[model samples]
Target: MQYSTKTKFFNKTLSVFMTVLSPVILLTSVQAKEQIPLSETRCLQKSGYQPAHKFSPEIREVTIGNQLFDSIFSLGVKNFSEYKAYIVCRIPVNKQSHNTEFRVKFGIKDDANYETAKKTKVTFFLDGQAVESQILQIGQIATQNLEVSKNNNISIEVTCTQKLYTLDYCPAVEFVEASFF
Candidate 1:
């Protein structure tokens, strides 16, 4: 009976010591990854987008499509001619982390007044190779979980052409929730 009571006491004391020490250890490992904003690189060749591109004055916090996102960059309003936009972000690789990725939530801004694009062609490239391509429509957004390649470069290309039947006006697109994790 005495042995059992001593064993229980020892276990409780060890548990308390571990509980107190865990936070200090965990805090040292926890960190936020700082990422740079996207810029134009001719959308990474003609296969994706044209070299002529422009961006919003600054990165802004925007509430779009029922979600609040940070570091949102957008293009200025332009004419309804041939429209294509692109963003190329080169992520800094952490050699220690194995499964690093560049994650982003983006879509055409859901604007009813036609300030936002109705539909556009979106493509993703990793390490200068096409990985995913799709049509991003109005009131909707898509996410790309791009794994970091050795080059650590990820490019996003959004384009609009005359092929789309319904929507005639060329509207701007909003890039939301861009980050590296």
Candidate 2:
């Protein structure tokens, strides 16, 4: 049998092309099999919070001046008593071995009357455990970092306990951002 020079060159080229393309196709198929949800930040409205007082316990999307924000978790409590607000969010996990990290940033809205602002106590919880607690005051921003293992629900409870006071005021805790990665 006699093979032409062009046929020999074509056979070699085909062999090289198959060798290079095999791994690329295999890699693509493997990646497609494992579909991981992208990490993202969701608003409190989407995450689910109990509704209260028209605006209380609602995710308030507001534009202040030129700044735009939609992550504010507001809880309006008016009185000198104990008030608790729970903001629960479920993190998506495809497998039991997957670990997710959550970052919760929040602050107390400043009030003209400093005494009214300092009368609130806020506590943060992960799952069902008390992770962090603080006496929320004006000009204070707090962050809670939690590492969640396996697939489970993440519940954030913001309990605002107001002390006995004379003036009438409604205190609220504004969540700046809640990010999961």
Candidate 3:
């Protein structure tokens, strides 16, 4: 069949539009997943010398160099040989017959002494079971995917041992962000 010049131009335009729009639509759809927050319950390990540090519920605006961050928990422990902080959050899941996978994204705030305190370790637990653990430095960001048959609670525990127990300067760990999709 023969077509007019206007029809031919419209067909070409439609083809180009689809080629450019397909990936954009797909990307937007993929990025639209709901992110659940897991920073409601905070627990700190008790120390022999002093009681555990309190978890600050107030979100503070922090600026490190050129980057700015909103931190939900700021844990600063001073005059201690070892410190531990725990952040527990319960994640709700759909009651499906099959298992589900969730992507957890979290980061540690950038500290001035992060380079000196390289021995700080952060462990992630799901349903009171250890899922992943890593030694974190300043400005370290991490992501992990967990597959479970049912919904459960998750926690991030940070442990740091200071080389010097002086009251001058102590190592600190700040939880900047924690969300799951």
lDDT tens digits by residue: candidate 3, 7-117: 999999999999999999898666544555544333444333455564445678664333677766644444355555666555656433222455554455555454345
Cα lDDT of candidate 2 equals 0.55
| Alpha carbon deviation, residue 141, candidate 1 (Å) | 1.8
Winner by TM-score: 1
Segments of candidate 3 deviating more than 4 angstroms: 1-33, 39-56, 64-66, 76-82, 96-108, 114-119, 148-151, 161-164, 168-170
Task: Return the TM-score for each candidate structure.
Answer: 0.58, 0.54, 0.55
- So what's the TM-score on candidate 3? 0.55
Query: Candidate 3, after superposition: displacement of residue 155 in Å?
Result: 1.4
Residue range 1-181, candidate 1, lDDT tens digits: 3568889999999999999999988986875555533442223322223464443335666545766655366643233445556666556655444436667777666552454445666778887788988776665667777767465677776666434444445444567766565
* Pairs in steric clash, model 3: none
Model 1 residue 155 distance off true place after TM-score fit, in angstroms? 1.0
Q: Answer with 2 or 3, whichever has the higher TM-score.
A: 3
Kindly give the stretch of ten consecutive residues in candidate 3 with the minimal lDDT sum. Answer: 39-48
In order, candidate lDDTs are 0.59, 0.55, 0.58
